[model samples]
Target: MKNIAIMGGTFNPIHIGHLIAAQCTSDHHLFDEIWFMPSGNPPHKEDEVIIDSAHRMEMCRLATKDHPTFRISDYELNRKGKVYSVDTFAMLQKEFPDNKYWLIIGTDSLFNLEEWYNHKKLLKIGAFVIVHRSGYDEEKSLEQQARLRECYNTSFMNVHMPQIEVSSTIIRQRVAEGKPINYYVPDAVSDYIHKHNLYQLGDDHEIR
Candidate 1:
């Protein structure tokens, strides 16, 4: 059976941290393919200033182009209305009945697993790989993992990697401040952000 791992997020600008996590996860050889799935409209981040879906998708494409195992998926991008993890997993399960699916997330996400939309159903559908970040509470992670295993028979794995202290929000803030964001994001993404003048002050573009 094919093992596919999914790393889903808003990917507001697709930074180096995201790439490193995905690459380290891939290095484990736990999955046949690692798909970078960008959400169209993140329900949890409704108040945040998200960039256009087209641009986010393009940046993800550019960021993962050099990696043979890395791929970008438009599953959530093409879906209408609110996108939930359970729905995405269900669709993939139906589409690839022979393949096993795994959901990859950070420690922060693991702590809030119960708060996600239909999270119990999501856990029942596929396994989870939690990537440990610096300062993350190991005890809490283990507790949550055990709870899920006992309650839903969910499978879990932990991956350790060097943490990169970069976030899309910080990158956007730097751009808005007219500061250089070199090395924060990939070169192609940096150029795209500059060429398009994204995240600049007073630029009134509707975020969808």
Candidate 2:
């Protein structure tokens, strides 16, 4: 069976950290293909909205351009309303019944799994590959772990990668301050931001 991994996020400005996590998870989880799906509208954080869907998709494309196994997906971007993980998984499961789909996320997001839309059903459709982030607990309570084991048939695959605290918010703030964000994002993305003058506009400027 073909193994597919889905990495969904805002990706305001895809960074090296995100790339590393994707690569690590792809290898560790043994996924045949890893698709970076940029969410159109996320229900998690309203404070930091998504950048333009086109630009975000391009950034992800540039970030994973070097990896043959990595791909950029605009499935969620083309859809309207808040992007739900369950909805995406269901669609893929229906299309590829022979393939095993895995959802990649960070340690922080796992903590809020209960709040996600139809999270239980999501587990039934696909497995989860969570990346480690500092300050987030990797160890789960025995009771909770047991429940997850019974409910979703999950497995914990740990990866050793550099801990990068740089975030898209910081990248935007740096752009707003006229600071250099050279290494924070891919060179192509940085150039695109400059050419498009994104986040360089006034305080009221909306991120695409």
Candidate 3:
């Protein structure tokens, strides 16, 4: 069976941190491919200002272009409204019935899995690979993993990667303040953002 991993995120602006995590996860030799799925509209981040999905998807594509095992998926982006994890997983399973999938998520998100929409069903859909970040509490992760295993019989794998201290939120803030984001994101992505003037003050426009 083909082992595929899904790395779904807002990817407001794909950064080096995201790439590092995906690469490290792939290094484990468990997955044959890793698909980066950028959400169209993230339900949890509704309060925060999000750029156009097209821009986000382009950034992801540029970031993963050089990696043979990495690919970008617009599954959620093509969907009209709020796209839930369970729905995405179900669609993928239907499309690729013969492949086994693993949902790649951060250690931070693993603790909040129970709060996600259709959480129980999502757990049973596929195994979860937790990517460890710096400064995260190891004990808390263990506790949550044990709890999920006992309650839902969910499978979890932990991957240790070099902690990248940058985030898309920070990158956006820097761009708005006219600060350089060099080395934080791929060169192609940075050029695209600059050429398009994304995240600049008063430039709130959606891609149609």
Best-matching candidate per lDDT: 1
TM-score of model 2 vs. true structure:
0.89
Ranking by lDDT: 1, 3, 2
Q: Estimate each model's TM-score.
A: 0.94, 0.89, 0.93
Q: After superposition, how far is residue 13 of candidate 3 from its true place, in Å?
A: 0.3
Q: What lDDT score belongs to each candidate, Candidate 1 first?
A: 0.88, 0.78, 0.87
Please write out the lDDT profile of model 3 over residues 1-208, one tens digit for every residue.
7888888888988899888889999999988899999888878887677888888989999899989999899888899878898888788889989988888889888988888999999887758989988889988898889888988888888998887889988998889888999999999999999999888877364221
Measured by C-alpha RMSD in angstroms, how accurate is candidate 1? 2.0
Show pairs that collide, candidate 2.
Answer: 51-208, 52-208
How many Å off is the CA of 143 in candidate 1? 2.9
lDDT of 3 at 125: 76
TM-score (C-alpha) between model 3 and the true structure: 0.93
Candidate ranking (TM-score, best to worst): 1, 3, 2
- Backbone clashes in each candidate structure, one number apiece? 0, 2, 0
Model 1 gets an lDDT of: 0.88
TM-score of 1: 0.94
